[model samples]
Target: MADHAGHCSSSSQDRRSHFLVAAYGYQGHLNPALALARRLARPHGGGARVTLSVAASAHARMFPSSPPGQLVVAPPDAEVSDGIISYVPYSDGFDFGARPRTAADRARRRRVSAASLSAIVRRLAAAGRPVTCVVSALLLPAADVAVEHGIPLAVFWNQSAATLAAYYHYFHGHEHLVAAAAAAYVGGADDPASVTLPGLPPLRVRDLPSFLVDATGGEHARASIDSMRALLEIVGREKPMVLVNTIDMLEPEAVALRAMRQQHLEVFAVGPMLPRLQLLQQTDAAGDDEGRRIDLYEQDDEKGYTEWLDARPRRSVVYVSYGSMLGYSRQQVQEMLRGLRECRRPYLWVVPRDGRDGDVERCLMEMDDDDGDGERGMVMEWCDQLKVLAHPSTGCFVTHCGWNSMLEALVFGVPMVAVPNWSDQPVNAHLVEELGVGVRAERDAAGLLVGTELAKFIAVVTGDGDEGMNIRNRASFWNQIL
Candidate 1:
């Protein structure tokens, strides 16, 4: 195994493998990408070096104390080790703050990032440690940059293999079918019927990615669709070996279709990439040395959430969280609060400070005061979510169905009540329902979750009912497999 002190040895240094990993700026995308990068860089006979590259704006958020830059290595507050993994920040046009709004802005940022990443690859090659291969996480431009540097490219599919197959078919053969269905549904303004892809399970129109079914998403949706198509097209031409965050036994059909050479692609199921929690059980052969979690936001649990959780009975607490980016309307917030109150379960909720903190804080205060027993529910800005999920008290997770969150829920054997907002979340919700691991909460036509429906599903999933028992058993079954 290689250590920081071994950097001085010539033979040991010569044997080190180097991989350049690039991920999009979003938190969901970065978490999986970095986790994979860490796994690749774990201690071994021959050492490994990983370079995590991200857009400048995201870099700033990850390490807010770092100075502005074009292409810089080891910015202040970057979590880097001497001989293991390192951080490299790149320009995405919007370096200071905010994401690309329009297609032109997105394209411009891609161009800038491509040039900067090419430079990083060149710099590494110039230094005696050439990058062996480039693994990109949802940032399609990184593939072109890797090719330009005369290196092999592997796309890290940040979502599930099922979603991968859906996109794969969309670009290969099912484009017209999906487009026509979406158009017809849009015209009728009726609930969309389920659509089937080649060699895959049937998916409701709502189960498909929002970019495919919802035209009202405007420029963002169109841009996302274009990027997804472009990514598949690139893979078909380049024939790069793809890596997905799923296992073979879990989604056999999707994995088989993914590796079909007839489509000029080969895919590998290499993940469920997660933080190996030493407290519960160890998954990797690396023992309990899982190291620090890769977090963009600093988590300060001033409320002692872990202590609160420690006092709860086993499998008694409900954990609720939307992902990093999703925010709720005030009405929806009240509905969730009402549902939690009605469910009569001990709960821990994460309420982010995205303009509605005051409302959420007030709600939490009211809920706390109304409790005859102390602290029926706890709310914090953020905490170590993976740790919370791994806790014994965590029985159910109320999730946004983001792929990372779903993967964690599966790992921890926690059933979910999915509240899908947009993007791939709806597809993941469909997967949760299809897999029979959990049930989706019912929503109205406008896509708002009803309080009574939320409370009812919570009772059904958490109570001793037959359906709840089945879901719980399936969740425990997957946890053992994972």
Candidate 2:
């Protein structure tokens, strides 16, 4: 086995391996896939060459200054390398980040992406750099391309193993049971029934992945359930190896791995899949290469945020951010502001102007105008979350409980006030509480996490009380172990 320092012997075959990681264009999907690509490109991780593939829209966003040809639709052989991993873009039939309005539009994206990826594979092989494996981050078309090309495939499960287990059982043999439980709960059942899957703890209906029980049946909800079903179907038919983004110590029982392998599926827990500061230092020592971290959105000035944190007292600032893909309503945002003001804590909050709602922009502008000199609060469209969490002044995280955010909070030893919204966030929030590292705030009947509840949970996580101390201690323990 290779040590943390990448000191391990590799076979000649390992050195010749080239991994093509095809990631979905979303922020949550891109982060872990990029992290894994970086790891595989390292000397300790088989010293393999890696190529990251995403839609042209995301590629253009990440490298906006690239030439027009590269931004629109990259040539089959066009690739950018940051002295380590290579990045290539494939057209997903929606280069401007437009969502598909119909099923046919969705299918067109898959077809276009598949064709572009296949071209890239052939082009690489023609240049004597054939991809030895394909690792997909929920990009379904990548699986078809790999199969068509006869290359080994692996799916990167970018959520907790527990959620993976829930999805597995929900598809395998427990669909009826889960559906019944969810329906009953939604119908105001007093019991709020629990589901006991093999090799795992009993999970309440609320703890399951939100897509499974969402009553809205909106397009997004339907699309989510369909995506999960297709992914599971591929798992069952192809039995490709799975690389989960979770720590073994965190999931001691390994319920997902056990359940999958019982039917001959291969799964590996390869995580704390975060950027290593030491690795960044090493990169710095080599040169001024700056592509180690990739973000789809432009970030706030690093010096400005770090300087603000440096001036604050140790363990005093509250860092609040909902992950990308979640846009809080104007009322919710106002309530959050009220809670932050009432808490009387210095805070840093991220509110991205994704241009989806004009009201949100007006609210954010109002907030900026109110906090003139940023003495009590600072608002950024987006900021480097890992840097803020790693700062000593950051005492607690008020987050949407995205898996990447949860992993960052845990690894940085920061307690959390989980305000999960949808998808796997609810499951991640449940695990946060189960791990004793955070408190999940209770929401009102309309699923609004109002000001009082938010303020109370913030205090519970960062206060001097016994519960706060225990949560902080557990967070520290996990941090050390990782």
Candidate 3:
């Protein structure tokens, strides 16, 4: 295997090779991609020049005040830097924040973004900062552009290694096995079915990635399957390196890494890819003290959640957030509120107002009215999640089991009550339980977590019972190791 630095030139004049780190427009994709770029640009990590490229819409949201001229499809002279890493926006055709609604729309966006990204590469090369390598966070167009330019490419798998292993094996040879398991379970099997992949434990049908299990169901599910298939095909044919967003210690057996290695692919575990705020503070560059994390959506500034956390006792607060993308149904929201109220713990909940349905908003308003004193709970549109998770008073995280959220909770030693919805969340929730650091809440026939069930899991995670203590101990153990 080649050393990462070997991808750059050895000549003194061209020593500082540029790396183009491209991520999807979503917050979950952007955060870890930005973290990797920061690590590469940092003095100790590599001291390389890093440019982070995202869809124009996300870039615009991150830097809303930038001049129109600078946000052109491939602005050659536009150089926006956060002191450490440069920022670039490639036109994904849907620059107005509207998602691709159909197959044709997705194809058109891919075509447009591929051209825009190619132009960016050419412009960078002409400006003498040629991208030595392209690191894509599951963005297919970036991979296409990298291949078009003959530059090295590495995939940044932003999910758990176990999830990656599942996808890889599902595509490589075990498709039928996984499909059969899911089909049997869905067809009302008496016992739950499981698929055992190489190097990893048996993953039950319910615990596998929801997209793979329901690959034929919806537009989103089909699209996700297509993307994964495309990504795996690329890795299989070209054998490009893969960088997973987890530590070796976390996945000690290195299941996915080993599986990829057997196929002659170079896979590296480079993760817990979190913002190094302390390291950023020591840098000479002048940038945001928060490690230049790009939040595409507005955050709540009026709510003093942090100050409220400070006043709470140690390990006493329940922090609830369903991530930026997942919106709860009205019933789900009401049930969550009821559960939190029943838990009787001071809770900080982040429910973003954008994209929320009218019914959900009304429920939130009614909950606010009901809790006039705001003594037991505080609900905000959004808050800095890392701050909330790292707070000393935060004891439990009621989360949707997003990979980033799971990593943060693990890093902070906060036990979780996982309520997985879709995509890789179920697999992440499985990992959460497998590690003994959290418990997953069971949903009813309607796939809704009732108030009582939610309350029960929260108590199991945060209570003084033996099970809760064991979960807390495991969380602390992993926290120290990570």
For model 3 the TM-score comes to 0.93
1-482 in candidate 3: lDDT tens per residue? Answer: 12454443233324377789998999999989988888777666667888999988788777766564343233433558878889988888888778998999989988998998999999998988888888889999998888887888888999988888889988999999988888888788843635888767877888888998893579989988897898789888877788899988787664446766888987788888886435344432664544556676667773477778889999999999988887789999999888898988888888887647999988888888898756778888877787777778999999999999999889878899999999989988988888999999999989899998989999999888999999999999977876
Number of the candidate with higher lDDT, 1 or 2: 2
Task: Show where candidate 1 strays beyond 4 Å.
Answer: 1-16, 43-47, 60-79, 187-194, 258-260, 279-291, 355-374
lDDT accuracy of residue 106 in candidate 3: 88
TM-score of each: 0.88, 0.93, 0.93
| Worst window of 10 by summed lDDT in candidate 3 | 6-15
- Evaluate all candidate structures by whole-model CA lDDT and list the values in order: 0.77, 0.83, 0.83
Worst 10 residues of 2 by lDDT: 1-10
RMSD of each: 5.0, 3.2, 3.0
Q: How many backbone clashes does candidate 2 have?
A: 0
- Residue 19 Cα positional deviation in candidate 3, in Å, after optimal superposition: 0.7
List, residue by residue over 168-277, the lDDT tens digit for candidate 1.
Answer: 88888788888888887777756555678865677767788877777686888889889888888888888777888988877777767733555666677878777655
Q: Model 2, 472: alpha-carbon shift in Å?
A: 0.8
